[model samples]
Target: MHGQTTFLNWNKERIALERIKSLDPIAHGYMDTPYYVAYSGGKDSDVLRILFELSGVKYDLVHNHTTVDAPETVHYVRSIPGVIISKPEITMWDLIVKKRMPPTRIVRYCCTELKERGGQDRFVATGVRWAESVGRKAKRNSLEIISPRMKDKIVLNADNDESRRMFETCSLQGKRVLNPIIDWTDDDVWEFLRYYGCRSNPLYGCGFKRIGCIGCPMAQDHERLRVFGRYPQYRAIYIHAFNRMLAARRADGLPTDWQTEQQVFDWWVHSTRRRREVEDQIRLSEVAI
Candidate 1:
């Protein structure tokens, strides 16, 4: 099956390159307009970088630092040639305190603030694969233009009617978002990486299925555990943040059932399993503070 999938993927790769070549005018106004890649320093992103080079398209690369990423991943991204490393205004720890609650899968404000802040007014390419998630599969188009105003509103967290109208009337052209390998699968990503001998993040070799923020609630319990166990310093930072959040809640006359930092950390990493229990505890201490 792997061999067959690889064979099919090679053909698909050729077709995808042709498709991107044909979109030069629509994506960048001309063949010479350089596009940008939102490189993640992961397997898929490495493949995307190579794909852009192979496609003979003029492009640059950008990697937004989430701050919560593994040290090895950050090092790897920094080591990449000519990659622009963009950092968020606030660190993940500070964002956690400002949010007043841990980021859950449903409310991933971090992505908007950290990950998707790139490609503001320029043509940007990404390594988004339809196979990665159902949401991306349904929502992402292979090639689409993002209004510069809308992009600004998203990154700036401004979502008012006036802002919308202002953006709608803005004279600046919208940015183009290109997903060159949107149709590729996991097997295809690894195959391409091996073929090119690309050096990906070292965290993958340490048994992480994906490389992103450590202790991210969206991760599975096993993955999260491995991350916490592997990186004690980050785990300590997360626990301290949780401790501070709980203290603030207590000071505000809210539920403070999870008293210790350890308790808060335990509940946080395993909260999904006991969602009702955690929610009920929070509800029990509700007050107009």
Candidate 2:
């Protein structure tokens, strides 16, 4: 069944490629116009980069550095040829300090600062899929809006919900945004990677289910645990940030919940415990060997 599915998917992808190629002449007529590929050094973005290259389109590769990205992911991006890295003028640490708390799903200032605003191009491409996040699933395939502050400025918007929202916000300010890979699925992404021999961040090989910010709240418990155990320094930084948040809350005379500190600590400790379990399993296997 898996093989049959792969075959069907590949055929569909070839058809899609033909359609894209058919539109290439029109797209290339605007060669003088700038397009940016938002590269995250993740598997998805890697696949997108390959697609852009294969399409024979001219585009600048733009990587947004969140400042809290996993070391492996950062290294992977830098290793790519001709990749341009943009760091946010504001650091996550600064944002957390200013906001006095870590970003949650409800309040994600990180995406605005770290990902969206960091892109240098007016038209951006991203390897965003609807299957990845709920927010992404709701976004339009293509749209144009004015930059947030400048009424006359237009930017093409693409990518997923987060990218769309970023474009919309920029449009409100008078910027345009564009997303070319909004319709691709996870399977399509992996297939592209496999077909193109594209390289992805090592973090994925190290058992990270999703690669974004080190302590992204969107991650599952097991993913966070894997991060905590595999990257102790990062885990410590998160704990320190959480501790600071707790202290700041107290200083502000905010009511404390017993679960706040416990929850953060548990998240850290639970990963450590899982790591130990894995080590034990390995040792047991060694004994049998």
Candidate 3:
């Protein structure tokens, strides 16, 4: 009988380096910019940043401030050398009041505004892995041409076909992505980060599995509750935002079941009764020709 252990030593690093080197021209041609590495102060992103350095590739490390990011995360992001921190004009609190609705799982406008706005019309590198989510595996590929919305995405799974024609189209049409670590597993990420001597974010030391915005809608209920427990101030701030949002809705003459900020908070985290309330309001706002 032949016995072999699952090898942690994979050629993924070499593959990633090759991808970085090969995609350099296309990235520059797309926007005359070096690859924009989206650094979110997470382990995966840290690994990618190190990999970019190892490849000696021309890339800029960029971090977008969500305002609601954990203090540890903000400090960690700022600590990274040469990382450009992009601050949004409006904060999460003001955004809620302006949108007149709290960002939910289905309607995550906060992510669109804070996180996804960067690297537009440019070739970007991300640490997104299929191991993170099933949706990522389906939606992302080695080379991708991403539209603002989901419908027009062109994802090419083949790294072998580094054809200039497709890249030219991506440059002309929408943002292009070069995701070298798309297939890496969680273990792969940790192994690479450790190998590169990157300690990663301080939150990880506190037994936090995922590092993201304090109250990101996409996080699980338990994770959200954990964040609220850890940072009680955020809960108060969100409630205040909700209060202003309710006022805005009332001024616009939009009827709602929630009157108090606590009630909105309850609905935001737990209540399923008025789940469609925000969507209904959005539908009503759409002008019919």
Q: In what order do the candidates fall by TM-score, top score first? A: 3, 1, 2
Q: Each model's C-alpha lDDT? A: 0.74, 0.64, 0.82
Q: How high is the lDDT of residue 36 in model 1? A: 75
C-alpha lDDT of candidate 1 relative to the true structure: 0.74
Model 2 weakest 10-residue run by lDDT: 1-10
Best by TM-score: 3
Model 1 over residues 134-169: C-alpha lDDT tens digits?
A: 987666756655664564322211123454333334
Per-residue lDDT tens digits for candidate 2, residues 147-185, read 455545433333245644444344243334444555677
Question: How far off is model 2, as Cα RMSD?
Answer: 10.5
**lDDT, candidate 3, residue 169?**
48
RMSD of each candidate? 7.9, 10.5, 7.1
Better of 2 and 3 by TM-score: 3
Q: List the residue pairs that clash in candidate 3.
A: none
